[model samples]
Target: MPVELTIHQPSEIFLNDAAVKVKAESPAGCFTLLPRHIDMATALVPGILSYETPEGREVFVALIGGILVKQGNSVTVATQMAVEGPLGDLKNAVDVMIREEDDRDRKTRAAVARLEADFVRRFMEFRKNA
Candidate 1:
C-alpha cells in the first residue's frame, strides 16, 4: 500500500501524492514510519527527515525539523517549522549543516576535555597540599 503525505512549514509546503513511508528525527532518535506505523508523536529537533514511496524517495522534503505520522494509508505531517529549497539548494544546505554540526561537536568535546584536565590538576594540587 502507498501512503500520501503533506509537509508544511512556516515558509514552505510540500505534498507527496505517492509516499511509502517517512524517516524523521525525534528527541529520542531517528524514527521511521510506514503505512503500518502506529499513530504517534515526537518532539521536533534539528535533523534530516526523508520520505520515500513506491516510486522511490521523495526529494522534496528530504530535510525537515520533525514530523507527525498518522496511521492508515495516508500520512500527514503537522509542523510549524521547516527549511525548504531546491534540490541543489537543499543539498548545499545539508552539507553546510553537517559541517557546522561536526565543528560544534568537536568544540564541545575539546572544551570538556580542557575542563576535565583543569579539574584533575586542581585535585592533584589539593591532594599534594593535604
Candidate 2:
C-alpha cells in the first residue's frame, strides 16, 4: 500500500499524490517515512522534501517551513510556500525565494517608515494650528 501525500499551502493544495516513501528535513535532522512507519509529527525547517511514487518516479519540493504529520498511511505537510522542481533547479529556486523574501521585508519596512513620518507631520501641523 502506498501512502497518501498531501502538501498544503495557505491558498491551495500544492500536491496530492500517492507515494511509496517520503523524506523531509527538520531541526533535529533528516528522516524518511514509509507506508508502514509509526505515526509521527515533525516541524520542518526550510529545506527540500522528496518522495518516491509507487511507479518508482522520484519528485522533490522545496519548502520554506511547515508542519508534517503522518497517520495511518497518510502524510500531510502544511507550509507557507513551496516550489517543486529537480534538485539542482530547486536549489536555484530556493536562492531566488530567499532574495525575494528579503526584498519584500525591506519594502515593508520602508512603507512603515513613510507612514510613521506622515503621521508625525500631521500631528505637528495640528499642534501649530491649535
Candidate 3:
C-alpha cells in the first residue's frame, strides 16, 4: 500500500499542505497507522511519534501534543507541536521525548515515561523470546 500523509504545523499555517505522518506515540500506545485505517481516535500525550513509509520508520519527538489514528489497510495521523530527529534513532529520539515532556506536567511526563518504558520492555521481551 502506498499512502502519503500531511502534517500541517500550526505555526506553519502559511503552508497548507498535509505533511508526511511519521511514527508517533499516544497515551494508549505506540503504533504506525497508515492511510485507510479503521478510524480510531486516541488521547495525545507528550512523547515520540514515528512514521515508517513502508521502507522504514522515521521517529520524531512530539512536544505538547496528541493525535488520532485509524488504521486498517491504511492510516492517517493528526498531531500538534513536533520536533524531529535523525533517520534511525527510536530510543535516543524517545529519550529526548521523555525529558521534553517532563518539562510540561508531572502527569504528562509520567505518562510519556511509562509509555516509552512499555515500548522498551515489549521490544526487549520480543527480542529475548525471538
| Prediction-by-prediction clash tally | 1, 0, 17
Model 3 misses residue 72 by how many Å? 8.3
lDDT of all the models against the reference? 0.68, 0.94, 0.56
Q: Stretches of candidate 2 above 4 Å error?
A: 103-130
lDDT (10s digit) by residue, model 3, range 43-120: 666665555555554445444555554554334445555556564564565567667556667888789999999999
All candidates: TM-score: 0.55, 0.79, 0.46
**Candidate 2 residue 127 C-alpha distance from true site, Å:** 14
Error of 3 at 106 (Å): 12
Which pairs of residues have clashing backbones in candidate 2?
Answer: none
* lDDT string, candidate 1, 4-46, tens digits: 7777665666554667867777788777788877777666556
Q: What's the TM for model 3?
A: 0.46
In model 3, the worst 10-residue window by lDDT is 13-22
Q: For residues 7-126, what per-residue lDDT tens digits would candidate 2 score against the true structure?
A: 999999999999999999999999999999999999998889999999999999999879999999899999988999999999987777777778888999999999999999999999
Pick by TM-score: which candidate is best?
2
